[model samples]
Target: MKVTRLSSKGQIIIPKALRAAHNWEAGQEFTAVDVGDGILLKPKKPFPEKTLAQVAGCLKYRGQPKSLDEIEDAIRQGVMEQWHDRVDTRE
Candidate 1:
């Protein structure tokens, strides 16, 4: 196991070998969790924040899109079918 000394500024230098192995660079962020005996350091996500535009076309639809009235009618039909099924099952 590698040993490291915590500086007076409360900063600990991760060993060069370990840092190279983990590919951790300068300004890398970490989240520290307190365990019973020691602390666990987890690397923070490196990805930038995503916007709606980035995910806008995630789902692809080749066919024509349904209108609002068509969508509502489908929902009503489904509900009526479910209600009729339940009533028939009861009788």
Candidate 2:
């Protein structure tokens, strides 16, 4: 077993060997859960896992398909309406 020391900053440095074994890199996110004896470090997922079949056909569209430009315009309009103070420096 590997040993590690917790720094004064309350941060424990995970050993490089274990990190390499798990393919963990810098900036990896983890959720620390306190078990009875110790804390369990679990990798935090950005989003819930879902298969194509599970998410497909979730939104029904009876009308005709929208053009890419039209969809972009709609998104832009929604953003403008929501964030009135937002600046567009690109323009």
lDDT of 2 at 42: 93
Query: What ranges in model 1 sit over 4 Å off?
Result: 47-57, 61-91
- The CA-based lDDT of model 1 is what? 0.93
21-75 in candidate 2: lDDT tens per residue? 9999999999999998999999889798899999999989899899999999999
Which whole-number lDDT from 0 to 100 does residue 55 have in model 1?
Answer: 84
Question: RMSD of model 2, in Å?
Answer: 13.1
For model 2, state the Cα shift of residue 24 in Å: 0.6
Q: TM-scores of the models, in the given order?
A: 0.52, 0.53
**Inter-residue clash pairs, candidate 2:** none
**CA-lDDT, candidates in order:** 0.93, 0.90
